[model samples]
Every structure is written in structure tokens, then in C-alpha cells.
Target chain A: MFGLMTGQKIDRIPVSPFAMGYAAKVCGFSIGDFYANAKVNFRSQLMAADMHGYDSSPMYGYASIGAWEFGGKIGFPYEVGHGAPYVIEHPVETPEDVDRLEIPDPSRAGSNPISMEVAKQCNALGLPAVFQVGGFITFAGNIMEPARMLLWMIRKPELVHKVISKVLAFQKLTADWYIDTFGPEKCMVFSGGATESNKLISAKQFETFTLPNEIAINKYVLDKGIHSVLMHPCADQNANIPHYRKIREECGWRGRYVWNFGPETPLEKQIEMFGAHDIIGGNVDPPSFQTKSFDEVIMLCKDNIERGMKNPSGYILMPGCELPPLTPPINVHAMMTAARKFGSFE
Target chain B: MNEEILNGLADAVIAGDVEKAEKCAKDSISADMDAYTSIMEGCAKGMNVVSKKYECGETYVPEILCSAEAMNAAMDILKPHLKADATAVPKKIVLGVTKGDVHEIGKNLVKLMLEAAGFKVIDLGKDVPTEKFVAAVKEEDADICALSALMTTSMIFMPDVIREVKRVKPSIVTMVGGGPLSAATAETYGADGYAKDASVAVKVAKDLVRSV
Candidate 1:
């Protein structure tokens, strides 16, 4: 079981690129169809993942929906290549507004509930399922208005902390539910979003606001005897492995974890630095899945497999970020074919 | 403001202190200094330093937006005095988050920099309908409309906005910029120009406005 959870040895280093709404696009289904018909969506994802010999499958849930369901008016326009939905209208306007915010019912309101139900279905079907939990910082950033959040972080630091407290409370409520129902250790994996890519915020700001929350979540999840994967898909070329190591150590988690590496990530270097405990996944450019030929996809996946095999103890092959929405199914298949050919069960 | 005071303003901006920024600007103005020079030379100059810090990854959005608000407040006091001197407006541009897209960091940064450069910016808030953009163009009698969309899906709305603008006023130059947008994609969408960042957007907007 080459999964973020379980921490089991693999039959071979597996290929698992996150299907970020790409399943819908590749299957030519509407969002309504994708969400409404979980069985159909599940079949397509299983087919795509298996075609690639992928270790696991992923399904789409709106990143902003958790916050949006909690009274934030977030939305995504139906279109080609929108990627993920983001907050459009903020529900909270004043410091007093935090008083009015009610924790959203994850079983009812937004895609979180839909995703949870689907997770349950997937689990019952004996499919490995990863529940996408909002990163403490990113979710906090999304719930409040981005512009206003920025303003409030400075103009009202105390208020920002208060809002973050509420976000954490709500997030924990949902996370606790998932863990209790699914049994954290057996549930495929729990992934969270603390995108400390230096592109969006400074390393200092990341250290201050992002890292603490990430560390908190890591402890919370790991304390439950579950694994936590930190997704930092920011476009910061300057980010190094030492910071990641520091985060992992500071989080006090001795178990295995995965880092969602992106284009700028030096996988070999990171392997050298944090390979002892951290498993590096992704670095395949998402757009390449759309723009490249099947041969190119095969070569890319082969290269990743070869690289991972160089240190099979510390690598997971996958796309750098969420797979682009327009990624071709053939490319995905080719990636799986290559992985099966070159992978080892070390 | 003296070098110490200017440094304080710089520190305030870096720390995102609006009140200290306002107080520093007022104190400098009361000290028999030219308001424009005090602003352009004092506060705006400090912000440019902060912007460099931001570029170098020394500051984040919270700090930057707060600093921008400080600059905005200081500018409010200094704008009237500059108007008395018949100050030049670098460009007159209309800006908005494109229809169906609402992420505003890049757009807001572009607006901040444009305003910092003395452009009269008409900022239509997020989720702007195409008609609102067109109406703003006609009403503001704007020279350029700068559109932004953070998501690739919402980037489709940029072209619709350009078409709406051209359909009503063919001569109006429309510039689109965002994470998902590139010059090639912008050309594919029939945009007049594209910028990858705020400074680039400022330059493009200035050039487009000047040429138009």
C-alpha cells in the first residue's frame, strides 16, 4: 500500500496524479453530472487511475466550497480550464460578522458533504480514498475576503486570529468526523493545503501564518494515528528542502508524510535532505498532460519512475499540482504504462 | 520629512501602519515641505522600497495591502495639494475583475501601482458583469480597461469583455492580465495587451493609454 496513510511497502512505486476536475473534462461530463452521479465519476476515476496503474484515485471537490458553504459566497463559472473554484463574495464584512458565522454542516451544504458521502461510498467499495481537508491557513484565507483578510491581518491582527480560531474549530469538527467515521489510520490519506509557495507570501509570512497552522494540523492528524500530506503547490522557485524539513520536525510527526512537489522542486536534492522521513510526490507539469503527446507522457512518467527508483524509499510519482483540467486521458494512461514498466517494489 | 521620518514611514509601510503613515504624512506637510514632494519623495518612495521588499519575498499580502492603504491615505492628503500645482495624471485606465471571476490580488495590485503612478483608475469590483465594464468605460469616458481573472475558467470571460467593449466602442483598448493569461492567450482572446505582473501591467497600461 503505497499511500500517504498505512505507510505500507509498495508492489512498486505507484503512479498517482491528482485528478483535479480532469476526470470530468476527460470523460466529457458536466460538473452537475460529475457530482450528482458519483458511481459514474467513481468508475471514470478508477478507470483513469488503473489505466495509469496508479496507486490511488482522486475526485474533484471545490477548494473554496468548504468556506463557501460556511456562508461565503464563493463560486466557479462553468468553463474550460477554470481549474478550481475560488471565493467571489465574502460573507463576513465586520469584526461583528464573525459572531454571526455558523459552522457549516458538512453533511448538507457544500461539496464537502458531497465529497464525504462519495468518500464513504468509495470506502465501502474497497477503493482507497483520500479525504481532502482544507489546510488551516488556506481555509482561513478563503473564508474571509482575500482583500479584506489581508487588510484585517494588519489592521486587525486580533480579529484575524479570532477568525482563524473559528476556521480551525469548524475544520477540526469536520476532520474529527471524518476520522471517527473512517478510522483515520485506515482511511486512505488526509491531505491539507498550506501553500507556502513564496509566490503568494514571503517566507517570513509563511513561517508566521502558514507554518504554525500546518504544524498544528499535522499534530492533530498524526495524534489520531493518521498520516498528513502537506500540499504546497505555490510557484516559488526559491523554496528549499530545509524549510520543509523544519516544518516536518516542528510538527513533531515521526511517521511518513508526502510533500506535493511542484515544477521548481529539486526532487533529487529534496530526497537527499528529507528523504529519511518525507516522501516526495509530484513534479510532473500538469499542463504537460494536456499539451504533450502520449510518447512524451510515457517518457515523463518513465523518467519520474527512474528517478524514484534511484531512491525507492522516498518517492511517489504524481503530477506537481492538481492535474490540469484539460489533461488528456491518453497521457494519463501512458504515465501508468511507463510506471508499471519501470517501477520496483522496494 | 527628514531621513529619520522617511525611514519611519518606510517602517510603517513595511509593518502596515495606516495611522502612523497618516501622522507621518501630516507632520511632514506641517513642516513647510511640498506635499507632492513629501508624498512622491517621502511616502510613495517608501512604498517603492516596500514593493521591492515584497518582490524579494520579504513581505506578504497582508503587509502589502496595509502599506497600500497607508499610501492611499497619505495620497488622499497630498492629491489636493498636487492638484493645486496641476499635477499630471500618468494615465486614465478602467480596471475590474472580469465577469464570473472574483480573485482580486493581482488586479488590486495593478490598481494600486497605477494609482501610485498617478493614473486615474476606475476600479469596478469583483464579479463584474460585462455590461458593467462597458458602462463604466462609457461613463468614465476611460481610455483603457484593464481586466483580470485569477482562474483559467474565468479567463474565458476576458474575451467576452473585450468583445463587449469593441462592440460598443471599437477604439477602446482592452488589456487583460492574470495567472492563467499570457501574451499568446491574450492575443487569442483579442486583447490589446497582456501583463504578467503588476509592474508590467502598469507599463502596458501606460503605453496603451499614451498610444491611444
Candidate 2:
């Protein structure tokens, strides 16, 4: 039976919705063993999730190279526990570089199949999983020269727009393909884009350069009548409460903005600011969880949940960013337990 | 010009009101006020206010950039008049985002602070390749070349940029900064200087130029 809740529909709000490699490691498995065998990885993560009372379980934490599978030579460690995938080599260097890069045929080449496989495994387990999708700018930008990407925004705005349009088309196409393959009603699409945050580019820049692509993607999903969630993980120094509010106002398409702490975003305040939204996720410091004891982790999770989960407005207990691969499994479970025990605000 | 025009110019620039800024600058010049005074005294003061607002978290990136744009417009109005024999208060530095890194907030901040502190900065913008950086140093005949990268993957290319600069002209001071960089890391990468913050970057630029 699905555990039921009133304040928000989540019967048991997901706890530790981050990379699961650390969980597998803490549960006593090798990294190679976990990646190769989803069952082992899933078992460890589910054990932690269930013990912690998590309603939903996370799949791989850092499959950033999902975009690189298109043709970019992404540096591997493929999942640096949960950090952004490193670009060992870029596929696009010049205008001609874009020519060499083809939007990866997801079902065929990269981690796309692995993700679908994991989703199926979760479905078979009678649990729900969110399919994570990467955005065009960060993925494509990373593969191209970084500085050039910014200049491209300035000098070759048209070219950058062309590439971004192509990338977004791929993202939407891939998401649709996943839904059609996996059955849309059974699957929820979780979209991610960090570059759209105000840290790297101004709101003007975001509006001019990033927002169009974002709007297009969100529109694509919304047009399908599918619930598409957006996770914008930016810790820009200029990222503040009002800016967060503005982004949500501008880009919120019945989905939510998953936030991270930055120089400007105080962890406690972010929870207060985002409490009104039904889909706010994060603010726990992963490093703290990695280093702290279960009790401290419990306290941290409890504090964030109390503030962040005031009313179901959909709360996801997660780290502010990538859950460092070294985080303790007990700590993660404790976080989940706290969320389960105390996420109600009726 | 009255305080209204001067203050308006400053406020318009800080507010990123380009039209109002241009109007204010032109009004003051037509009123027989020196364009350099309007710029250094009015526009610079406005920029300082915006920077302070930024420091206090009152403004975000869009606002800061808009303010920078307003200031830039004022600069455009005043540069022609001030171009004559402008004495270098501090040595000129060339700045850019490193190869493969498009993150530019920190780099832009450094550029503003360096200019505020009286150093001429030739910003090459973000994601600059090694060749462009090398060319910038030679073209500007800059005394220092500053580089920045936000991602660890891209920051790895910072050393290569520095290497190319040294290869072209080893005498040019090569500096690097960003979230992923550490002082130890900068030294390891053969950079002459490392700064963690924009204000500190200005001081470092001044110090590097002085020593050079």
C-alpha cells in the first residue's frame, strides 16, 4: 500500500534523492560491482531508502556524460560518486566541431539504456523513479570551449542559438522517446539545467540566451501533459532569494526549481523562501553529512525538512549539490528517516 | 552641471538605464562640464554604489551587468576626451576565462575591480583558447595576463594557457583565479599570482604590476 500524506500528496517524501554510489559503497560493495550490477546498487540504495523511509529511490547520481554519449569524449570516472562528469576531451571546438557531434542516439549508445533499465527495475519493484535528463547548454557548452561558449553568446549568438536549439530538440526528443518507451503515466521526467541560473549569466543573459531554450523544453513536456520537474543546480555568487523567485516565476511550468546553496544563498533561508512551492528539493550540505554522525545528520535533515517541508508543496530531502561519493549510508538513511518521521505540516 | 544631472548620471548607470545614462552624460557635457569629470566622478561613483549593492546582496547578476553596461556607455562618451595622453596609474592587464570554461561572473568582477583600482584591463571574455590568450598578451602588450575557470575539468586547461603565454613571452605575469583554484594549485600550474576574490584580485594585479 502506498503510504499516504495530506499536506502534500507524497506519502513519504523522498529522502536522500541523490547519487546512490555512496550508498552502495557504504553497504559494502565495490564501485565497479555497483555500476555493473544494478541489482546490487538498487538493493543497497533501496535498503537505505526504505530504512530511511524514503518514498522514492534515486538511480545513478552523476550520469552527466549522458549528453557526451552523443559524440563528445567525456572524461570518465563516469560517476565521480555524484559530481559533474569531467570532460576528458571535447567534441566541439570550432563551428565545424558541432558538425562532428551528433545528438547521441540515447537507446543505443550511452547511459540512456542503463537509466531506462534502472527505471524498469524500480517499476518492477513497485516503486516510482524519476528519469533525469540533462540540458543542452551545460552539456554542449562543456564539450565546446568554455570561454568560447560565453563569447559565442556574444559574438556568434546565432550559431550558439542554432546549436542550443538542436540540443534542446534532442533533449525533448529523448525525453519523449523515454516516456513512449517506458509509458508516460508510469514515469515522471526530471529535467536539469544549471547554466540557466543567475550565477553565470545575468537574468537578461538568461532571458536572452538560456530561457528560450528552457521555455521550449518545458513547453514540449507540458504540451505532452506530462509532469516535468526542473532541477536548477546553481550556486552563483549572485544567486539570492529574489533571483530564485524570479527564476521560478519565469520558468516554473507546473514543475519546481531544485536549488543549491551558494555564496549568497544561506541554507536555512532557502528553505523558507521555497516553502510555498510544491516541488522544492535540497540544501543539506553533503560534506557535512559525509563527515558527521548519524545524529548530526538526522538533526541536519530534520532542520531542513521542518523549514523546507512546511506543507507538501512537494519536498525532496537532498544535499545542496552532489552527495559526495564518500557520504555515509547511515547518514543518508537517517536523513530519510527524519523526513519520513517529520515531513508533515498539516 | 547641477547635482541632479551628476547624480542622475550616476544613478542611471548603476540602474543600467542606458538611455538615461547617455542623456545625463550628454546633458552635463552640453552644460560645459568636462566629460572626464562626468565619467570618473559620476559614472565611477555610480559603479561603486552598484558594486557595494552587489557586496551587500542587494543586487544580482542582471543588475550588476546592467550597471556595468550603463558605465560602459558613459565610458564610450568620455573615452574620446580622456584618450589624450592618459597616464597609466597602474599597469595594464589582460583577463579572460580559460579554455573550456564559460563561467565569467568572477572574471567580470575582477575586470571591474581592476578598472576601479586604476588598472587598464583588456578582457578577452570567457572560454578563451591558449592561442587567443597568447595573442592578447602580445597585442595589448599587457604586463599581466589573468585567466579564470569555474569547473575542475576546464581549470585543468589553465596551466596550458599559462604555458602558452610563457612560451610567447615569459616576462608577462600570468595569473589565474576561480572557484576551483587554490593558491597551491596556481603555483603548481606555474601562475605568477592567484586571487580568490575580485577585490583581492585588484590588489594582486597592482602588486604583480608593481613588482614587474
Candidate 3:
């Protein structure tokens, strides 16, 4: 994984199934435990990585973090169709609530304690620990209803900015705690940004709302000696490419950063937009693992790997998002199958 | 005066100015203009421009939402005045995000756009159980049943929901939308229709309603 992160010429390009709850279910563990239980989250992912022979580390967080962490209800994955924990009720429902909101102390926040416990496990075992700082825009939405956040952008820009600043502080301070505890080399900052995508806002709005926090967090972690960042710019963000370019110019570590794109933006376009230095991570449609047959999935993986292999810095073959919790193992195996067959440099 | 007020109302919705839209709606009422004309000519026309901007990538989700608020504000003023004989509700759709998927940003946008296009929508809300969707279809006698799912995980339930809806009422058109869905996937799931975005959803709903 480090070899892939450092852009070395390894024998084969690494494959990550991008499993979360899928990993838990794969290992006969409860999907709900994957989120609320630290040991379960770590052990399930570790076992799944070992079982599938995929080349990624077990991760410890979910995209829907802020609402729960900042004082709201969060639902664990108890149902067959649930992939990750979701915000059941946002902390700040009304504009008035925004004024009263407080950023929980990092050491005792909603799920940070669980997150820290998971990181400690990874650190003691010499594993690549993922420290999650969900993108500011998405986190802001997690704290409040997303539609309310967007409407606030027009009617109450100041209120929106207020929540964003508080959330941004929570993210940065949480990063500080992780880095202070485990040091940067042991932790790879993983950013998942669903709301930052153009699906919710335009590129200009992205520049206004998401870019500053992105640039700040990248620079912050880099300054503290973190060697890697895996940024999942979730959903269709073809239009936000131009604004994303600014982060590259300002933060300065193209090779160390891996930008994962979904099917919304073509892989080739992402490669070109990201340039020749940063590692690019995906393009495989996650839905295929549930819908397509094994051979069909292998074919898709091969197509993605071949396109990604052409990237100058490096490429990692993985699904664009978390695999469906019920994704078939044969289809999951197809990813490694394609990686071994077509991704070999030997 | 009615022409000027109608045009101004369109401008307010397009601008996403809720206060102005309400004022325009009130002005139309004071003028004693046809309330149906105020909706068909005023607010919906403005929503049309907002949808076009979305297609061109000139607008964002918040803009559409703000526009919806403006239109709905005007609607609150104009709806009661719509003469029963003149107001012919286009079609009714039962819409919600699929079970186990709580994300409803996409579903909400589609509902608003469907309303803008004059469809009477019965929103079932997010994380809706499959049985609830089927029940809604039967109870409302909905022309179309739309399901949304943001995760590959929850999207697996779509085909089953579609199947059950069809099993319960074969005449109802089933449609699906979300981040992970596509036109092909929709067909593969046996959906009668699909739309990639809210604006396109409005267009798709129109065609599906006509077919029904």
C-alpha cells in the first residue's frame, strides 16, 4: 500500500475493494457493529482484506460523521441494504440552533472516541491508519439538513458560514489529536466529500464553500508530516475539476495525494485534470458489483486498471464508492483477478 | 396589468426571491387574474428557466431549492384561488428515497420539479419501506411510483420495490433515480422510466404520465 502511495514501480497495481460495511458482512460480523464498535470495524476490515487479498488497509470512519459527533442521532447499519451509518437527526435543525451549536471537545466527541480506539489498534499493530476528516461541505450538511444548508447559502450566507467554520475547526482539531497521538507516518488522512460534489453545488459554490477547507486541511496535514491523503470526491464532480485544480497548486504534493473519481467524471478526464503527478484512484461504478456477473466485473476492472495504469504518478484500482454491503464475493474477487492479470508490470 | 404581474412573478421565482414572488402572487390575486393562469404562466415559467440553468450548469442545488421556495410561496397564495373546473392536476406520483437510504436531497429536488411541472406528488419521505411505497401506490392510485437510493447498498432494494409495485398494480409506471442509478440500470430493474437529474425528471414524468 505504501509502495502504491509513494509511486514506486511495484510488480502489480494494488486493488482496493473499498469495502466498509461490506467487509463486516463478508466476515460474518454484524454490519451495525462496523460503525459503533471499534474492534469490530478494525477486525472485520482486516479480515476482509486478508480474505479477499486486496491491497488496502482497514479504515475506521464513515462519511456521515459530523451530525452524530456534533450532537445528533446516528443509525447503525442493521438492515440488509444499509452500507454505512447515517444521520438520523441533524443537531442543528433550525437557523436559531446554529447560533447555539458547539464543537464538541475532540477527545470526547460523538464517535471520535471510537475512531481513536480504532486508530490505536491500527497503530499498535503497525497498520496504515486512516484518520477521517469529512469534507467541510458534507460535514456542514451532516450537522444540518443538506437542503437547509443549500437554502441557507442564499438566504442566510452568514449562518451557513457559521456552521462551516465550527465544523472546519472540529475536523482540523480532530486531525491534530490523531497526529499528536499516532504521528503522521502512521495515519493517512481520508477525506470523503459527497456534498462537495456538483450534485449539490456548482464549481463556483465549491470554491466558495469547500475549497478553502480542503486546501487548509491538506496543508495542515502536510505541515504536520503526514505522507498521504486519499480524497474521495464522491459523486458527479466533473464541473468542480477546475476548482480542485487550485488545491493542487496551493497544497503542493501531487504524488502523495490520491483523488478518487466516480462514474460521473470519466477516468481519462480525471487523469488529465489532475495532471501527471498525483495518484488517481478509481472509475469503476460501484453498482456493478451488485448487478454484474463475475466476468462482467472483471472486464470492467480491466478497463479501469488499463486507463489508470497510463497515469504518470500512479494508479489504484478500486470501486468509486463503498461496495454494496451485499456485493457478491465472486464479483469482489474479480477486482483482484483483473489487477493480477492486467495490472502487472512484470 | 396581468401580463406585467405574471412576468414579474416569473422573474421572482427565477431570481429565487421568495418575498417578491409572494408579493407578485398577491398582486395577481388583487388584479383578479385567473389563478390557474398565474401558476401556469407565472411560477412554473420561472421554474422552467431555473431548470434550464441547471441543465446548462449555471445553477446549483441550492438555487433550485431557493427557486422552489419562491414558487411554493407564490403557490400558497395562488392554490386556493385555482378554480376547481380550471385546475386539472396533471398526474400524481408517489416519490421517496428507497429503504435504508436516508439521503433525500435528490428526491426532494425531483419532487419540487415534478410539482413545478404541475404533477401532484405524494412524497413518502426518505428511508421508505418497500411496503409503504406499494401501499402508497395503491392508496393514491398514483400514475408513477418513483424510488431513489444514494448507496449501492440500498439500491439493491429497488428492483424488489419495482417488482412488488408491479405485482400489486401493473398499470402504475415505476421509475428510479439516485447517484448509483442509470437509464440502463433502471431498465434492468424493470423500471418503466428513469431520469438523471431533477429537471430531466420533470420531462420524464410528463412523458410517463402521458403514456399512462
- The 0-to-1 C-alpha lDDT of every candidate, in the order given, reads 0.67, 0.64, 0.86
Model 2, A1-346: lDDT tens digits are 1232123344556654565656566667655555556576677777755665555464643434434656665443333222244455566678876656676666664555666777778878755545665455565566564545665665567767777766776677677776786665555566555554454455566556666666666656656655545454545524334544554565553553445443234555655666566356656755566556899888988887776665335556777655555666677677767876886433
TM-score (chain B only), all candidates: 0.84, 0.81, 0.97
Candidate 2 chain A, run of 10 with poorest lDDT: A1-10
Compared with the real two-chain complex, what DockQ does model 1 have?
A: 0.37
At residue A336, candidate 2 shows an lDDT of: 66
User: Which tens-of-lDDT digit does each residue in A1-346 have in candidate 1?
Assistant: 3443456655666667777466666666654456555665676676666555566655545546446767766555364434556666666778888778787765565566656767777778775445655354456667676567667766777776777677666666666777788887645445444334455655555565555665666667677776545444444434534555676788664666766666567668667766776777757765567656999888888877677656534667787776766666778787777766777654
| Residue-level lDDT tens digits of model 3 in B41-141 | 99999998898888788888888888888999999999999888997656889999888888888898888888887889999998888899999999988
Compare the candidates by DockQ and give the number of the best one: 3
Off-target runs (Cα >4 Å) in candidate 3 are A7-9
Give the TM-scores of the predictions, in the order they appear: 0.82, 0.60, 0.97
Cα miss at A98, model 2 (Å)? 3.3
Clashes of 3: 0
Cα error of candidate 2 at position B64, Å: 12
Local accuracy of candidate 1 as per-residue lDDT tens digits, B54-165: 6666666667788888887776766666646556644568899876566777888888777766678899977788889989888877788889986555676777889988
lDDT of candidate 3 over A56-111, digit per residue (tens): 88777788878988999999888877878888899998888998999889999988
CAPRI category for model 3? medium
On a 0 to 100 scale, what is the lDDT of residue B19 in model 3? 96
